[model samples]
Target: MRTVGHLLSRPVAIGTALVLVMLIAGFVGWRLTGGGEYVAPTPSAAPTVRADTVAGRDSLEELVAGVRDGAKPEGKGAAAVATRNADAIGIEGLSARYVAESGNVDEDGSWTADVDMSWRAPGDPTLSEELKVGFDGDGEITGFSADEGTRMPLWLSGPVEVRRTGSTLVVVQASAEQADRYAELAASAVKQVRTVIGWDRPRLVLEVPASGLDSALGAQPSTYSSVAAVTATVDGSSTAGSPLHVWVNQDVIGDLDSPGAQVVITHEAVHAATAAPTNPHRPMWLVEGYADYVALRDTTLPLSKTAGQILAQVREDGPPKHLPGKAEFNTRSEHFGAEYEAAWLACVVLAEAGGQEALVDLYEQTGRGVPLERALRASFGFGVDELTARWRTHLSDSAR
Candidate 1:
C-alpha cells in the first residue's frame, strides 16, 4: 500500500480554535494510498520431495488436510495453530477455510505447507491467498510470514471485530462497539460520495487497526507513519475482480472528533468510489482535490476553518505557480496539508467556474485518457495555465 496511490489525510485530527487548521495539521503526515496495479507476493517454490509421514508418526496429509475446517485440535498441530490464528483475529462471524495445496517435511521433523487460506466476515466477501506456514519437530506450529507486496489482513495478523452497515463493511482491531462506530462512519462516507458520484455504487470497505506496525499491510513503517487511511489493492496482487480497499491507521485516525472523522472517511470514500488510484496518468491535484472537495462539500465550516493552510500560504507566499504534483506530495509527506488544501481549492475553482457537473465531467474525461488541457477547454472553456491563473487568484482572494 505504501507505493500505491495513497489518498486522504487527517483521520485522527483535532486541535486549536480553528478546526480546519488543526485538521490540516493532522493531515500533515500522509503517504498517499491507492494505485492502478500491484505486484503479487512471490510464493515460495513448493518442494517436490514429500513425505506422507513426519518422523514416521503423524501423517503429514492428515495434519495438512485438517486445516480445511480451520478447527483447533485437542492439543497441538498445524491445523490447530491456524485455527488459533483465526480465533485470535476476533472478528465476529469470521471463518477460515484452508486448502493444503503443497508441503514438505524437513530433516528435523519439521514441515512446511502452502495453504490456500480463505477467510470471510459477516457482510464482506471472502479473501483467499496462499501463505506458507510451518510446524516444528513436536507437532507445534513454528512460524508464518508474508514477504513484501502481500496484504496481511487482520484475520491473518491479530484480533479484530467486524460490523456491517448497508453496503459498507468495517473491520476494527478493537471492540465490537468500535466496529459499529466505524460502520456508521462508512455509511456516512457512502452517503456523501453518493451525493455527487451517483453514477456508480460505492463499495466501502475499511480496516481500522487500533495498534499494529504501519507495515502490517505490507508497507514500510516510515512510509505512512502519519497517513489517516489509504485506498489500495486488497491483496497486493491486482485483479479485475478484486479492485481496492481502504485502510485506516487507527493511531492516526483516532484523534478526530465526529465531524473530522466523517470528513476523513468520506474523503477516502470518494477515492474508493472514483477508483482514483487505478489511473496513474491523471493529475494528482484533480484526484486528491476532488476527494477533498466532496468531503468538504456539505460542511458549514467557513473557508478560514477548512482552508486555513493554503489561505495562509497565499497570504505569506502569494499563490503557487502551478498545481500540486506527485513530487509535492512525496517530498512534503510530513507537512503536505497545505498542498491538499490547495488541491481542494483548485477543484473548488472548477466547480465554481463550470458547476459541479462540469467538474465531474472534467475529472471523468481526464481519467479516460483525455488530456487535461483538452478536458479543461471542453468542460471549463480554459486550459491548464488559465485554470492555474484563476486558481492563483482564487487563493489570493480566499486569503483575504
Candidate 2:
C-alpha cells in the first residue's frame, strides 16, 4: 500500500483532487531538508588585502559623483539608517492591514526600509508571529515586506465587529442606518458593565422590531403586556423551553434616555448574559437586584448618590438585616425598587468593607450549593440580628 504522502506529493497525475495532501507532503519534505541546508563560507583568519589609499582616489571621486547623481549610499547597513528617521512617519490603525512598511534615513546618507506583516485573525486569543524585513542600499531602503501569503494559516478571517461604548453594545443592524447617539450610549454602558463584571465584547446583529421579536419567540397577542420589552413565556418551567422573550419597539429609536434603543439593547443583553445562567433556586432579590444594580451603577450619578437614598430608606423602615427573598420581592411590588437598591448597597458595602475578593467568595458560597443562612454566617460572622443592626447603623451614620 502506498503512503498518503507518497500518493499526494509524488507528481502522480493530472486532474487529481489531492492538492491539499500534496501541500502537506511538500511541507514535510521542506521541513526535513533544512531549507536546502544553507551554509555560510568561512572567513579567512589573516587579512590578505589592504586598501591603497592613494590609488583609489579617482574611484572614490567617481563614487561621490554617483552619490550626487541620486545613487544611495551602500554598505553602511539598513539598521543604522532606520534608527535616525524612524519617528518621521506614523500609521494610524495600521493593524487592520495584513502588510505594513516603514523606513528612515541615517546620518551617513543611507536609507532603511522596514516591512512587517501578520497572519492572525483580529479576535484570536493566541498571539500570532509578525514577520519583519529590513533593507538598506545607498543608505536608503528601496523595498521591504513580510512573506507573501503568510496569512493563509490564520484561524480567523474577518474584522472584529463588536465595539464597547459603555455598558451596552452598539450593534448596527443591517436593516437600519447607524444611529450615532445610540452607538455612543451603548458603548458607554458596556464599559460600565465590564467594570463590574468582565465580559467579552458584545455582538452586533441586525436590528429587529417588536413584531419581529414576537415572531421569533412565536408569542401570542394575549400572553404579555403591551410593553415592547416585556418578557413572554414559552413552556413549563421545569421542562426545557424558552423561559423569556423580549420585544423591541422600533418606533422610538431616536430616544437615548427614555425608551432609548441602546438602553433596551443593553437591558435585554444583561438579561441574557446574567439572568439566563442563574440557577432556578437563586433569589429574585439578588437576580433582579443585580440587574438593576448594574443599570443604576452605570448611570452618570456616583454610586453613593444614586443608591444611597433608597438604601437609607430601606434601612430605616425594613431593617436590611431581615433581607427578603425572591418570593417576597414580587409581593412588595410598591417597594421593589427600594429593595433592589438596598440589596445593591448592601453588596457594595460588603465589597468596600471586606474587599472584592471576600465579597466574591461570599457570592460563590451562597449562590446555590450552600444554604443561605450558612453562607451569610460564614461571610459576615454575624447572624441576622447583629449583621442587620450593624448595617442599619452604618447607613444611618453615613447619612448624618
Candidate 3:
C-alpha cells in the first residue's frame, strides 16, 4: 500500500525513537520516516535578473527545441555535447527554465546555460530536475548533463557505496563495515519476505544523512525519523513500469543483528515485493497489519514486548471503539505504534480463525479492489462489524 507518488508532509519527532523500536516489526504502508517536528527553513530572496541572462533564457529554450528536434549542435565542448544528448534522451516531461548565475558565453563562440526544470503531471507528485545545456553560441549545442532530481542524492554524488546481497542490491551511505552489515540484513529481509509472501527481491537504498534521505524521498520532510524505512515508487510516477526504491535510515537501523531490525527489514521487503503503480483502496490496517504478521511470523519475540504499548493503552481505556484508520497510522499521530500493534493483532486473529491462506486470500481480494465487507464475508464468513467485535474481544482477553 506504499505508493511512491504520495509525499508525507508531517515531520517525525525525534523523541519517538522508543516507540519506533517496539513498532519497527511492522510496516506503515507508506514512505514514512521518524524525525523531529519539522520547522521549514527560511527562504532566501530571489536575485535580480540581468539583460544578458534574459537573452540566455531564450537561447536555452532554443537549445531545448533543437534537442527535441534531434538537431545536433556544431561544437566540440564536452559539457555542451553532454547537455544536448541529455535533452535528446528526454526530461521525463519536465519544462526547463534558465538560471542567471549558471549561464556563461565562452570566447570561442561556445556557451553553457544552467536551467532548473520541474514536472507535475495530473494526479502525480511534483518534482524538479537540473539541466545544463552547452551550445556553440551560434545556436548549435556543444555538451551537457541533466540531473534527474528524483534520484537518491548519495547515489548521485555522495559517499554511498554499493554491495550486492544475493539477488538484491544494497546501496548505503555509511561506513564500509556498516554497509556490509546492512547488506546482510537486507538479504535476510528478502529471504524472510519470500518465505512468507513469496515476493521477489527489491533494490534497497539506505542513507545516513537527513539531506540525502530527503533528496531520495523527493524532498518531503518527514517527522518519523524513528521509522526504520519506507518503500516508495520511482520518481513519484504511478506508471505500471515505474521502478521502486526502498529507502532506509541507517542511523535508525544500525543494529542489524537485533530482532527489531530484522523485523523492520522484512516488513519493508514485503512492501517492496507487493508494490504496484496504484495500490488497491484496501483498509490501511490490513495493508500494514498483514505486513507485520509476516515480518514477525518466525520471530521469538513475546507479544508483550511487541504489543506492550497497545495492551497498556487498552487496559487503561478498554478496546478501541472502531478499527485504526489511515489517520491513526500517520507519523504525526501519538498512538502510531499502538495502531500498528492493534492492526497486527487483527491479522493474527484472522489467521487464527481461518488460517494463513484465508488471510492471504482476503488480502489479495481486497488488493484487487474488492470491498472490505464483501471480501470479509467471502474470506471469513463475517462482515466488518462482526470482525471488529471479534477482534475487540480477542484484544480484551489478550490484555488480561
Best by TM-score: 1
Each candidate: what lDDT? 0.71, 0.42, 0.66
Runs off by more than 4 Å, candidate 2: 1-190, 198-271, 275-278, 292-305, 308-321, 377-387, 398-400
Question: For residues 1-400, what per-residue lDDT tens digits would candidate 1 score against the true structure?
Answer: 5312222233333232256555666555332443435578899986564433343224334444454445556644434544554543333333223345244566666666555556554434566656655656565455555555455656555445667655777767787777888989999889888889873656788878666435557766466666778887665654434566788877777888888888889999988787777776579989999999999999998888788988887888889899989877773265467888899999999999999999999988987899999999999999999999999999988888
Cand. 3 Cα-lDDT: 0.66
**TM-scores vs. true structure, each candidate:** 0.70, 0.40, 0.64
Q: Model 1 segments beyond 4 Å from truth?
A: 1-137, 142-150, 237-242, 331-334
Candidate 2 weakest lDDT stretch, 10 residues: 151-160
lDDT of 3 by residue, 1-400 (tens): 2321222222354336546644764444222665555588999976642334545566656645654455655564442443343343232344567764455455554566666765432223555666565555454434444434444333223334566644566656567786687677778877777776756444543334333255555555564465667776757666654556677776566645678887887777777777632575679899889889989998788879889989999899999988899889887688768998999999998999899989989988888889999999998999889889989998899899
Number of the candidate with higher TM-score, 1 or 2: 1
The Cα error of candidate 3 at residue 281, in Å, is 2.0
Between candidates 1 and 2, the lDDT winner = 1
Candidate 2 structure quality by residue, lDDT tens digits, 1-400: 4665556566754336367668889889989887876579998785333322232233324333433343433343332222211111110112212233334433333332222322211221222334333323332232232333232111111111223332333222223234344455455545555666545744322223322233333344333223334332222133223333234444444334543454455555455444333356455555555555556544565546555656566456644556556654552255544565666656656656666555555655655567656766787665555545665765565555
* TM-score attained by model 3: 0.64
Best by lDDT: 1
Q: What lDDT score is found at residue 74 in candidate 1? A: 62
Better of 2 and 3 by TM-score: 3
